[model samples]
Target chain A: MPQGQPAVVPTDGLTTRQRRNRPLLVLHTGEMKGKSTAAFGLALRGWNQGWSIGVFQFVKSAKWKVGEENAFRALGRLHEQTGEGGPVEWHKMGEGWSWSRKQGTEEDHAAAAREGWQEIARRLSAEQHGLYVLDEFTYPLHWGWIDVDEVVTALRERPGHQHVVITGRYAPQALVDAADLVVEMTKVKHPMDAGQKGQKGIEW
Target chain B: MPQGQPAVVPTDGLTTRQRRNRPLLVLHTGEMKGKSTAAFGLALRGWNQGWSIGVFQFVKSAKWKVGEENAFRALGRLHEQTGEGGPVEWHKMGEGWSWSRKQGTEEDHAAAAREGWQEIARRLSAEQHGLYVLDEFTYPLHWGWIDVDEVVTALRERPGHQHVVITGRYAPQALVDAADLVVEMTKVKHPMDAGQKGQKGIEW
Candidate 1:
């Protein structure tokens, strides 16, 4: 194939196998938004299309979330169907003690987290993915927990066939500008917005 | 064009103009979710790429939403950019009525609305587009306003290089089955769950 030549699909429909190799970019959201579950939904889709993908969850403060369980199971399902190695990968910004909720005393710790995010960014940019979702990523930038510009630059430089999504409220305009798609959710009518409490299966 | 052919993609990646053309699927979400805004964003992108395209927003109840100013503004922008008749097309679906905080029942209103939505859907499917987004469309089927199977059939039968996006929660399994891309919105933790109000511009 010529350099950066996307599969030369003529006007005709793609053969079943030709359709399988297209790369994707997915943004796994962080914060109170539902990034994890959505990421799984897209992964199931990528799996259906016969694409091998890598999934990373960037978490600094929390460990072992209850909500991400379904996604892991779905990843297991994808592996079962394809017999590929693990499809889901997890990254904690710091070692347990460093990633703890306590405030960092010096800039060194903060710098380290930035480097870690950059390293991840480098990996994502180089690897052409069937799908990549940055789960709950924007919150760190807003709170000074991560370097924002580096991530955006890396995303811009990422493989164009890779379809990327970022989900978070109050996201930086630069990030939104970089993304091909953005979904800003509103509360026009919600049960929780009213006085009712969230029930387990539906809310969680 | 070959039978069942997707839109023609040049083998050299260049159209007659020498610029590359990427087969795009643009999905504009309505229903208080940033449908028009997202669509406009993509349109701006397509313009940047010098793409020949058509844009349509297919929904019955949303022709004019006074409560949401940004939503209306988003529609306006897309309308202007697409030029003339509609960036937002009106289609109908039978007859219906909705009771409200301000206004009460009205006749032919539901029919007119459905007509508006159907009109948009028809125009979008028949036309050749690099990207097409059906904005604020998910709830119609859930509410028995539109036929789910027919919509899927129309999209599958289209002869072009098209990437379509349908955004909303509770997407029908039939739709999911037909889709190369599927995303569901999950509300993990929201400020509203704790009685916090939505911040201005952020929520809008």
Candidate 2:
């Protein structure tokens, strides 16, 4: 053992680090991307894990954008074949965040939101439901339509076993910091930028 | 020893007459009245009876009407709680009765209708789904946006199990005659006819 070469250090038996925790998936940024697919995939994981679920969308519009409808359409085929309700509970919230010009005596200033956070509070308070997905929920907070801290506090109060997903572009830093896992999807490419516009099935 | 009353009808079980056999539920007026509720209840009954269902709507807009949005909102809660994904499918046939308006100098009337029906037919084909709920789908047919005979033939060709629901008033005689159940919700009383405008959650 007196050779010129130095002896190698001995390694101990591996303890633990490879172990994984089923994370609470938080997705943000980009539309018409594969977010819904990923979210629905997470729903499947929740279902498989025997977790009851609730899906809620914020900042609603007349346009039938992705939210509850997409889940129903996407999961309908799955439910039929599997004899299971793949996703559970669907809720969509709306906000009046546009400008309407005055007609006559009445000033049609639709910039400020009318209905405050009452309905949202009710929904959040009834938060016993598991695996909650708050879709497009960040916008209202971004635009100051709702109190973000209040919602974050409620979310933190939820059980550790319960998974929650908050989806929207530019999610509040408070929400991101509160989350156990955060996924930010940087837009690599988009059709809208080129004026191609969104088509049904593909976008909706 | 029986009384004059025609032998007491066996009230124990549902008779053929009580069952909605491939019935067509039509809601013409643009409002979420008791009619929408009744239609869902009727559909729920059919769902319990183990029928393959089809839900479709031909609309001039993908945009949600105030009344329709409300109807779906009320229904949304119930649907989330217990919907098993019946044969109903929601559809939006791209806007307008004709393409002449959008086509600019040239008109693509036949092309537009062909495009619409082709898409609709594809969904209704036996290979794909069953139980068609044509939500507010009658107006296009009535307005000559879609062909009446084509609509008639589609329903007839639809399997007996494929219960069709057409919602709207002033339904063509062909549709009226083809349907198994015809319910007309006459305007006995309405707030709109009066000076009072619609309030949120109630009217819409």
Chain A only: TM-score of every candidate? Answer: 0.64, 0.64
Native contacts retained by candidate 2: 0.00
What are the TM-scores, per candidate, against the unseen true structure? 0.41, 0.38
| CAPRI level of candidate 1 | incorrect
Model 2 has how many clashing residue pairs? 17
Q: Please name the candidate that would achieve the greatest lDDT relative to the true structure.
A: 2
Shift in Å, residue A60, candidate 1: 6.3
Task: Provide fnat values for all models in the order shown.
Answer: 0.01, 0.00
Off by over 4 Å in 2: A1-25, A30-32, A62-83, A95-127, B1-204
Clashes of each: 36, 17
The alpha-carbon deviation from the true structure for residue B157 of candidate 1, after best TM-score superposition, in angstroms, is 40
State each model's C-alpha RMSD to the native. Answer: 22.3, 23.5
Q: How well is candidate 2 docked (DockQ)?
A: 0.01
Per-residue lDDT of candidate 1, residues B61-140 (tens digit): 43332212332233334446544212332222223222121234454544544554565456557664544545556666
Predicted model 2 interface RMSD: 28.6
Please report how far candidate 1 places residue A67 from its true position, in Å: 3.4
